[model samples]
Target: MNCSRVNLKNNTLYKIALGLVVAVSISACTTEPTPPVETNELPCRVAGYFKSQDRVGGFYRCVWNASINRWIQYPYDCPRGLEFSEQLQACVKP
Candidate 1:
């Protein structure tokens, strides 16, 4: 086997590994999620779904994190042309 060819193959593998490492690290880190209310607060004391107090067609979910022993709120939005129906507790066309 030619030494130069072997060196080039090793270099290509090294670059590929480095790229994968960077992609994984970036994906592992979470950015701050969007806030749902003017005060940027959610009463996550109870774990379940909650309506967004500010925006129309918006909602959020309160999930229990056993590792932290607390509730975390994740904001979501209904699909375009739909709104969250608090009465029905689901998204509906308004």
Candidate 2:
């Protein structure tokens, strides 16, 4: 009988190589999203002071005032004593 032996296991080396590759791949995958660049400037000049009265937890309303030449924000509630005349188109809810 010939008494000879050969080691046929290389699990430790394989595991180390795999771990290094996984670590490198994970590090390469981390990146921050780029912010969008602003392309245009405001066209209209702010004529007067405008205030927004939107409620903390409710829908928002936008109003374009041709008189004051600026957009104003109003609360979700309907204006007092104003019978929401469908003709004026006063309030815009978004």
Candidate 3:
């Protein structure tokens, strides 16, 4: 009878330990997802900008330097009396 009681207690303890382990495992797997980082600024206007292509809007294609983390403009300068136009996607006399 004592042996049977011991076996029952051991079995109960083992089941409790297994239940705790399963609960912990499930909690570990249910973490909330991380939020995305926002990057609102334009890539071309940042310092250390690198031109990627020739004039698209009277401005060379450019990218913001990853280190600087700011908007950057293209390298080519617009001609006098003209300006680069985003809507026109080219340099304009206006």
lDDT of candidate model 1 versus the reference: 0.79
lDDT of 1 by residue, 1-94 (tens): 6999999999999999999999999989967876543336557787666677876778887877799876777788899888887678898999
Clash counts for the predictions, in order:
0, 0, 10
What would the per-residue lDDT of candidate 3 be over residues 1-94, giving only the tens digit for each residue? Answer: 6999999999999999999999999999996633323333234443342322344323444445468865444355567767677666666776
Better of 1 and 3 by TM-score: 1
TM-score of decoy 1: 0.51
lDDT of all the models against the reference? 0.79, 0.43, 0.57
The residue-level lDDT of candidate 2 at 79 comes to 56
Ranking by TM-score: 1, 3, 2
Q: What C-alpha lDDT, on a 0 to 100 scale, does residue 6 get in candidate 2?
A: 23
* Candidate 2 residue-wise lDDT, 1-94, digit = tens: 3333222235666788999999999999998633322223232244322222233222223456789866554333345433332234443333
Provide the RMSD of all predictions against the true structure, rounded to 1 decimal. 6.0, 17.5, 17.0
User: Which predicted model would earn the best TM-score?
Assistant: 1
Residue 56 alpha-carbon offset, candidate 2, angstroms: 24
